[model samples]
Target chain A: MPTKKGTASGGTRRTPATGSRAANQRADAQRNRAKILAGTVTAISRNPDASVADIAAEAGVGRVTLYGHFQNRAELIEAALMDSLERGEDVLSEVPLDGEAAAAFQRLVASSWVLVDQSRALLAAAQKELPAARIRELHENAEARMRGLLLRGQREGAFRVDLPVSWLLTTTHVVMNGASEEVRIGRLDPEDAPRFIDAILLPAFTQKRDR
Target chain B: MPTKKGTASGGTRRTPATGSRAANQRADAQRNRAKILAGTVTAISRNPDASVADIAAEAGVGRVTLYGHFQNRAELIEAALMDSLERGEDVLSEVPLDGEAAAAFQRLVASSWVLVDQSRALLAAAQKELPAARIRELHENAEARMRGLLLRGQREGAFRVDLPVSWLLTTTHVVMNGASEEVRIGRLDPEDAPRFIDAILLPAFTQKRDR
Candidate 1:
């Protein structure tokens, strides 16, 4: 079957040749957008107070192009934070949730370790740059997802029901935040961080079972 | 009887004394000590950069007297941190560990609320005024106690067994550190603070129950 040709003149219509070229341009633009965003995030992570000019310089994009992608500072920061969270969420989602509750809990703690370890600077910048209202909004979304998973585990009798799901989620953050600080200061060997996690988180989340 | 004669000299020790009496003198000195400490703590909380002279003025003591109590800025700040941690430990110790695990957990979380709350200013000063090595030393002591409680709870079959107790204990600080920033800016309600504690801590520590 022959494809319909573009309508001429009055309306803007693209021929198949033009459409294919447009798709390639769109893909190239998307790649550029990703690079600019990544560059901005890295700059801000390095310096919480980094300006748009600095970000543009790092990305090798003009100020106009940077603004074209992000309308303002808050918008740029928000996008960066969202991107980081999305990455963290992807990691957490992939963690195997099946097993004894204790085992599952360990996986959860370990996953947090990975997230915090990787995103320490970015997370710190988010904490510094975002307003509390925005931070709370972001936190609430994460908390909801975490609580749902934990509650399911609890309901399945793999996790404890006595403690509130919210608390457990907060506790996970606390462990990672504290451990990250230690790692940053060289007080903790990065490789040994998991042991620190095990010593405290394992005991807190695990149920007593005969060895 | 012989009481009047006893009161003449030796009995003066037990009696409530006034004016230039030794007991009155001791009481006045004790009050002065407390006033100075309270003043220093308040000033430091508001601005850790406050000088010893400023702290003395706030405490209603002479600069010389402030120096008499603390050798220098480092000593004063260290003492203040220690005092804060001591109060924190006292609060944790007061939680009834012997009660039902859930009830005990609730009490612990509630008690911890104030500790977490007070830590904002303390941590800010710590980040600025204290060395990382010094902070780690303090954290180690605090973690030791927290770890014991978590282990005890696990052994009692009250807590889950998967995550590390160390991770749970450290994460409590992260939640506080993260949440305190929100609370300070009024973006998060102070009353709702407990929900944060409940969300992460309870799940991390409690065992899966039938409920």
Candidate 2:
């Protein structure tokens, strides 16, 4: 190997090969970082007070590797929280905001439920670990998206115009959160959550006479 | 004191007087206990990890007095949680369950919101400190009452019959919890919470054409 390296360094071809290996290493590092982030979400969600070693174990990475990726618990938690929110936003983005307001609202609710359910542990951990201000900031994007959709629904006459869009958005958010808890506790069937949510929420947003 | 004891030993009338004084003392103790319980709810709600001294201060009692009433933090938390549930039940009982299903449901929601709003901190604390089974036990009465109301509403054709009563009950519980959070976070106006709850929930439980 030493003799081959000495010869290879003298050739122009070695530089490109070394560069490609470095690129591959960087990609592997990025993939590992993402896996650690996902693992942190699950670990923290299951136990809000989980240790870094616990998270590393859940992530299937070495403790040293996890520490190398995240300098501290706070940094790792922040990353996990952001990761959850971003995934939730991705789910929301898949929903067509401009379609029939009621139908779109239902789609949004159903799709968002999947994200909400997956991130329950993360949400619980964040509430316990993060400050109110930070939690609010993390929630702002989801709130804005909801508010915009609600207002659009109201404007299109799919939702009640008399009620403030903020109220509608707040109600939907709360119901969804509550529903998730119900499902978690075995009070509501997880399979039926979307329908349960729509049955309860669709009426709230739609016109009184239409229901 | 020696003279009084000698005189009391000689007099039959002193026995009744002493008994009355003892009764008064017991009544005063009961009143103080109630105050402490109420105060603990407020203190714990404001700060989930509130200390015994902090709760005693909120209750306007001495730390020693608080300890005399509740031997430890766990006992005090149990009492606070029970007190909240009892108060909520009282509110539910006041709303006549036999009246028109929709009207009764609205009254139940309005009355329950007041209790729910007041106990947010206690609920949060309970979730963190108490076991899931204990939390379920504490919530049973409220759940039963809501289930009854939903069933009654569906029977009367006041609400959509297609949805299960359990689903309806779960939805109502979650929405109320969510609404409480919204109020807690200052996103929804506290003074308007009951009305807002009614506006959103009435439709969910009631038939669309009926509205």
Judged by lDDT, which candidate is best?
Answer: 2
Model 2 residue pairs with clashes: A45-A121, A211-B208, B45-B121
TM value for model 1: 0.53
Each candidate's root-mean-square deviation in Å?
A: 11.8, 7.2
Off by over 4 Å in 1: A1-29, A139-142, A156-158, A208-211, B1-172, B175-211
Cα error, candidate 1, residue A153 (Å): 3.6
lDDT tens digits by residue: candidate 2, A108-174 = 7888889888887777676656665797788798788778888888887788877677778867877
- Quote model 2's TM-score: 0.77
**What's the C-alpha lDDT at position A164 in model 1?**
59
lDDT (10s digit) by residue, model 1, range A1-69: 122333323222788667666766665566656767788777876775688899888777788988888
lDDT of each: 0.67, 0.78
Give the distance in Å from residue A47's predicted Cα in candidate 2 to where it truly belongs.
5.6
Task: Report per-candidate DockQ.
Answer: 0.20, 0.56
